[model samples]
Target: MEFRDLNISESIMERLDEKGFTEATQIQEKAIPIVLDTELDVVGQAQTGTGKTLAFGIPIIQKIQEKIEENGRKNKKAVKAIILTPTRELALQVHDEIDSVNKGNKLRLCTVYGGQSIEKQINKLRNGVDIVIGTPGRVIDHLGRRTLKLNEIDFLVLDEADEMLNLGFIDDVEEIMSKCKEDCRKLLFSATLPKSIMELVELHMGEYETIRVKSKALTTELTEQIYYEVKEHDKFELLRRIIDKEPGFYGLVFCKTKADVDQLMRRLNDENYSSEALHGDMNQKQRELALSRFKSHKIDIMIATDVAARGIDINELTHVINYDIPQNPEAYVHRIGRTGRAGNKGTAITFVEPREFRRFKYIMKISKSDAKKEKIPDVTEIVELTKTNIIGKLKQLIQTENSEDSEDLENYEFENLEIVDELIELADSKVIIDKLISQLFKEELNRKSYGRIGDYGSRKGNDGRDSRRDGRNDRDRRDGRRNDRDRNDRNDRNDRDRRDNRRRNNDGGSRLFVALGSMDNMDTRRLLRKVLEKSDVSKDNISEVNVYRNFSFISADEKTAKQIVDSFRSERRNGKPLIEYAKR
Candidate 1:
C-alpha cells in the first residue's frame, strides 16, 4: 500500500518522500492506520524487513503533538513517548530512523543507552525532550533517578520485544512500565511473539490490534548459511583468509562490538583489501561516506555492527558474514535481512566455535534459519576465488567499451600480440589474459594469510608471549633430560654387548603415559580408541595398549604421541577423559 493511503500528517508524508519511501510495507500498511485511529495498544509481529519502525514511529510522533497541545509547554518535563530497545546500538538505530522521518518538524528527540556517559543524557533530558529511545538498563536508571519523567508519557513502544526478553531485560522493562502512566498507549513489536511476550501483551497492552506479516523468519532457500568452527585466537586470521578467497563478494561482516569492528577493519586494510567500517561512533557524514563507498561499488566489503547497520538500506548486498553470532535470535534475522533483499540470493556465513554452536543451533531453530554446516575454504579455494574475481573484472572492462579508454586498451592489446595474424593474435591474447589474471591475484595475495591450526591462546592466558615461551622452555627441559637418560642407558648397554661379544637387541615399543586415573571413572579402552581415531593414528603404528586401573597407557609413533598428549591437555573437546602426558 502507498504512504498516501495512510492518514498520517502531511509533514510525515513529505519526510517519507524525502527518505525515498513511497509504498508502505504490510506492517506499516495495517499498523499505521490502526495506530493513527486510536491511542490504544498494538502488538506487531513481523520480520526485520517488514518496516515495523514507521508503523509505530509515525503514530508516536503524531501523539506527541497531541500531548503537547493537551498539556502545553508549562508542563514540558513530561515526555510524550518512550521507545525501549534491546541494545544501545538498536536504540541509536531507532532514534535515527525516527529522526530521519520527522526532520523539518518541531519534535525533540534524545537517545539514552549505556557506553555513552549518563551525564550528557541527563543534561539533554534537563534541556527538555519529547521523545526518548533507550535501552532497558539505561532507561531504568533514568527512571529511578527521576531524570526521565514518564508519568506523563502518552505512548510506549517496545521494539524487538523478543530480543529484550532474550537479553534478560524483561524485569527491567516491567519496572519501567510501572513508572509510566497507567493510561499510556503501548506498542510491542517483535519478530516472533513468544509466550512471555504474549503474556506481556495480555497484561500491559489493552485491546491491542495484532498485525502479522507473512515472511520466513529466516529464509535460506535462496542463500547459503554456513559457519566455520574456529578457536577465538584463530578467528581473525581465518576471517582474513575467507575474505581473500571470496572474490567480488559485496558483503557486510558483522562484529558484536564497535571496537571489534574497528580493529577488524584496520586489519583488513593492512592486508590490502578495500574495506571500510560502519559504527555508532561515526558522525552522520562519516556514516554516509562509508555507505556511499559501499553503494557505488568503490568498496568491496563493509564491516559493521548490528546497531550501526540498522539504518543501512543498501541494495546489491550479496553476503552477510556474522563474525560473532548474536546472543539474540531476532538480531540474527535482522543481520541476514541486509542481504536476500529485492528477490536476490545472498549468503550468510557465521564463525562458530565449538561451544558456540549449541547457542548457534538454538538461534537457527527459533529464527527458522536454514543454515548448514560447511567446510571452511582451504587456501586453494581462496586463491581460486581471488583469480575468478579478477578475471570477471577484466572481462567486464573489456566488454564495456568506453570511448575515452577504448583506444588505450586496443593499442595495448595490439602491442602485446601479433594482431596482423587474426587466429594467432586471438590465441595469444587469450593466453596473455590468463597470465595477467594470475598475476593480478598474485599481487592482491594476503602475505599474512595462514590457517591457524589449533591455537594455543587459551593455554597462554593472563600473560601472552611470556606464558608461551615458558611453556616451550619447560617442555624442552623435560625432553633434554629424557634424552640424556636414554644416552647413558644406551652407552652402558653397548659396553655390556661389546664385553660379551654379542649383538644388542630391543623389543619394547614406545610407551604413552596417561594422567587420568580410576578416581576419574574413565573407561580406558574407549578412551584409547577415541584418542587414536581423533589423532588419525594407524592401528599398525599403535603397539601394546596397557590399561591400568588408575592411568591407562598406549603405544604409538612419536608424532601421534605428542598429538594425543596435547589433545588431552587442551581440554577443548568434550566427553574426553582428562589425561595428560605422565610419561612417554
Candidate 2:
C-alpha cells in the first residue's frame, strides 16, 4: 500500500514522494497504522534491510507532528521520541532517515553516539530536540551528565534489539528504559526474539501487539546460493579464478575476524584486485571512507567482519563471499542479505574446509537454506566463458543493426561498398566473420591471462633459467663429444642454479614467524598479501614464504623485515598478536 493511504500527515506524504518512496514495505504497512491510530506498544520482528527504520520512524515522526498541531509549536521543543540502536553507524543511519521526513524542520532531530564530542551532543540537547537517536553507552553518558531528560519522551524505539543484547548493552538499555516515563510507548524491532529480548518485553511493554513479517526460506529469493569445498591452501587461487571468470564482479567477502579481514584485503590488493578492508580496528572516518568507495564502485570488493559490516546499505552489490564461515547461522543470513536487494539478481558463495564442514552444515540447517555445492571453474572454462560472452555481444550487435527500427543505420552511408562487395565475392561474409572472431578470441584470451599466474610460476624445478638456456644450447650443438661436454657443464650449472634458488626461497632474508597458517586457511599468497598490504615492504623486497599447518614463516630484507615484525607486534587476529621474529 502507498504511504499516502496511511493516516499520516500530508507533509509526510509530500516528503515520502520527494524521496521516491511510493509504496510501503511489509513492516511499514503492518506497523505504521497501529502506531498512528493507537496508544499500545509494538514488537516488530523482521530481517534486516526490510525497512524496519521506516516502519517505526514514520509513526514516531507522525506522532511528533500531531503533538505540534494539537499543542502550540512553542511547547513541542522537548524531546518527544528516542531511538536506541546497537551501534553508532546504525544510530546515524536512522537519524538521517528521520531527518529526511522532517524536511520542513517542524521537528528538531539530533543523533548522539560515542566517538564524537559528548559536549557537542550536550549543546544540541540544550538547544532542544524533538527526537534523539543514539547508542546505549552514549545515551547513558548523556543521562549521567544530566544533559538529556526522558521524562517528557512519549515514544521509545529499540532497533536491532538482538544485536544490542549480543554486544552486552542490555543492562544499559534497561537502565535507560527505567529513566523514561512509564506511559511512553515502546517499539522494539529485532531480527530474532531471543529469551533475553522476551524477558525485556515482558517487563517493559504493556499489552504490546506483535507484527512479524515472514520471509522466504532463504533471506532473499533473488540470491543464488552455492558453496565450494576447497582446501585451505587452494582458496586464494580459486578466489582469483572466480574473479577472473566473472567480468563485472563486485563482491563482499566476509571473514571471521578483524585479522582475517585485514589479511584477505591485503592479499586481494597485492594480486591487483580492487578491494578494501572494513573491521572494528578502523576509526569512524576510515570506515566511512571505505564504505563510500564501495557504494560509488570505486572499489569492486569489500573484505569485512560481521560487526563492522552492520548498518551498511548498498543496493547494487552483486555478490557476497563467505571467505570464512560465520559462527552464528543468523550472521550468514545477514551477510548475504546485503546483496540480492531491490529485485536484482545476486550470488552468494561459501568456501568450506573439510574441518569446518560440520559447522557449515549446522549453519545451513539452521538458516534453512539449501546452498548447492559447486566446483571452482578452471582456467580453460573461464577462457571459454569469455569467448562465449564476446560472441554473444557480436550477435547482439548484428541483430540490432539488421532490425527494422534501424533509423541510425539508414542515415549512415557506406563509402566502402566496393571493398565490402569484393570481400563478399571472395568469401561468404559468414566465413570471414568466423575467421575474424577466432583471431579476436585468441588475442582476448592471451590479453586476459597475462600476469594472472604470479612470479611463483618461474620457480618450478623444470621451468627455471638453467633448463631453458641448456635446451636452447642443445639444439645448436653438432659434435657428440662437444655436445656431451656442454651437457655436463649445463647439468652442473643447473644443479647450482637449483641450489641457489632453493636457498633464496628458503632463508635468503630476515625471517618472521606468524601464528596463523594453513589451519586458519592461510597460504603463501595470503601471507605475502597480508604483510605487504599492512606493512611498508614491497613484494619484491619480500621472499621465502613457507606456510605450515598452525604457523608460517616469511622473509624479507633485514630492514623491511624488522619493520614488518614491529608493525605487527601488537596487531591481532582473533585477539592474539599476529607475528614474532623466528628464533635462529
TM-score per model over all chains: 0.61, 0.52
Looking at model 1, which ten-residue stretch has the lowest summed lDDT? 474-483
Instruction: Tell me the tens digit of each residue's lDDT in model 2 across 1-584.
Output: 88888887888888888877998989999999999998889999987557788899888888887777777666544789999986665677678778888887478889887556667888989988889998787788778878898998999999988867765677889999999999999999987898999999999899899999896565788998998767664677678777878878999988877898888887777556899999878998999999999989999999998768874888888889898876445568888988899999999999876545554664675477878877667667777788888878877875675455444656655568788778889898999877777666643454333222232222235223443343345322211111133245555667978886666545545777799888887876567657765775655466557788999888766777888988887787777668877787
lDDT of 1 by residue, 153-260 (tens): 888899988867765667888888888899988988998888999988887777878889886545646677876766565677677677666665789999988899
Evaluate residue 143 in candidate 1 and report its C-alpha lDDT on the 0 to 100 scale.
Answer: 74
TM-score of 2: 0.52
Which stretches in model 1 have alpha-carbon errors above 4 Å? 69-71, 215-220, 229-235, 247-250, 254-265, 276-299, 303-318, 324-345, 352-366, 375-584
- Give the distance in Å from residue 421's predicted Cα in candidate 2 to where it truly belongs: 30
Number of colliding residue pairs in each model: 3, 0
- Candidate number with greatest TM-score: 1
Lowest-sum lDDT 10-residue window in model 2: 474-483
